[model samples]
Target: MAPSRILMAAIVLVGLSGFADAPQRYVVSYSVSDHGVAQMRGQALISEEGDVSVQGSDQDGGHAFNATLNPTDDGLVLVTSLWRGATKLGEPTLAMERGGQAKAEFGSDQQRVVIEIAPAD
Candidate 1:
C-alpha cells in the first residue's frame, strides 16, 4: 500500500462521546510499519491525569514503555522511558498536544501515527 493509504488505514478509531462531568479515557494505538509490515506495535490507555502506560514489541521480543504526560507551557510534555527486561534503553521527551489526530515518521522510514479514541459514556 502507498504511504498515504497506510496512514489513512491507521487513523484513530474514536468512540461515542460521553457525559461532560466525567473524566474521559482515551485508547491510543500505533504501529511502526514499513511496507505494511509492523516492526513494532503499541497501545496505551491515557487517563485524564495524563498517565500513560504502553506495551509494545518487535521481532526480538516485547518491551514496556512508560511515560507521564503533563501539561506544559506549550502543549503537553511526554517523557518516555523504554525498557527491555530490566535494562533501560533511552529516554526521549516530546512536547505535543492532544487533539483530533496526528502523524509522525521515524528516521528509518517507519511511519508512526497516533489516534485518540474515547470510550462511550
Candidate 2:
C-alpha cells in the first residue's frame, strides 16, 4: 500500500475511534401531576451511567426543586429530603423503568410524576 494512503487510513481510524469513545447521552423529561393537576415540568440529561442532572420549576411559581435521580437496581431512586425549598413530601420514591410512574405524597395530596427517558433520535 502507498505510504500516504496508509497515513490517511490511520487518521480516519483515529477519528472514528474518538467518536466511538464518546459517552452516550439521553434526554429525559418529566411531568408532575398533583391529584391529576399538572404542577411541574422539567427535563434532564442522563449520562451513560444513569446519573441525572435535573432542572425543574413549579408551574404555579411558588416552589422548585433541583435534585439528582440516581439509577438503582430496581429503577430510578429519588430522595425527597434532597428536594430544595420544599417540605411535607414523601421520601425514597422509585420511578420504575417498566412501570413508568413515579409518585409521592405531600401531606394529604399525592403527586404522580411521569418520567420518560429515551435514547436520542
Candidate 3:
C-alpha cells in the first residue's frame, strides 16, 4: 500500500478509538408514587459516571433519589438510592446495554419509586 494511504488509515483508526472512549450521555427518568398515586415525576440528563439527584415534596410527603450512571464491560449500571418522606426506600439498580433501557422499582404499596435510564438522543 502507498505510504500516504497507510498514514490515513492510522489516523482513521486513532480517531475511531477516540470516539470509543468518548463519554456517553443518557436520560434518567423517575416516578414516585404514594399509594399507587403519582406523587412526582422528573427527568435529568447525565453522562457516564455522572451523578444526579432530584427531590420533590407534596402534601403527603417528600420524595428524593440519588443515582450514578456507570459503565461496565457487559453494560451500564445505575446505582441509586430512593427515599419517600423520612423513610428510605429500598436501594434499586437498573442495568442495561448500550442503546438499551432499564428500570428499577423500589418500595411497596405505601411508597414506590420507579427509575428508568436510557441513552439520550
Q: Which prediction has the highest lDDT against the true structure?
A: 3
Please give the CA lDDT of all the candidate structures: 0.53, 0.53, 0.85
- In model 3, where do residues sit more than 4 Å from their true spots? 1-21, 106-111
- Tens-digit lDDT track of model 2 for 43-116: 66654445554444544334443344566777555433324245523334445453244454333347665545
Q: Which candidate number maximizes TM-score? A: 3
Where does candidate 1 have its weakest 10-residue lDDT segment?
112-121
Q: Once model 1 is optimally superposed onto the true structure by TM-score, how far is the C-alpha of residue 118 displaced, in angstroms?
A: 8.9
The alpha-carbon deviation from the true structure for residue 104 of candidate 1, after best TM-score superposition, in angstroms, is 3.4
Could you tell me the TM-score of candidate 3? 0.71
| Candidate 3 per-residue C-alpha lDDT over 28-116 given as tens digits, one digit per residue, 9 for 90 to 100 | 98887889998788888888789999888878788788889888999888888777788887678878887688887777899777889
Better of 2 and 3 by lDDT: 3
Clash counts for all predictions = 0, 0, 0
Over 4 Å off in model 2, which ranges? Answer: 50-52, 56-84, 88-109
Candidates 1 and 2 compared: the better one by TM-score is 2
lDDT of 3 at 35: 99
Model 3's lDDT to the true fold? 0.85
Q: Candidate 2 — worst ten consecutive residues by lDDT sum?
A: 81-90
Give per-residue lDDT, candidate 3, residue 3. Answer: 100
RMSD of each: 15.7, 5.2, 4.3
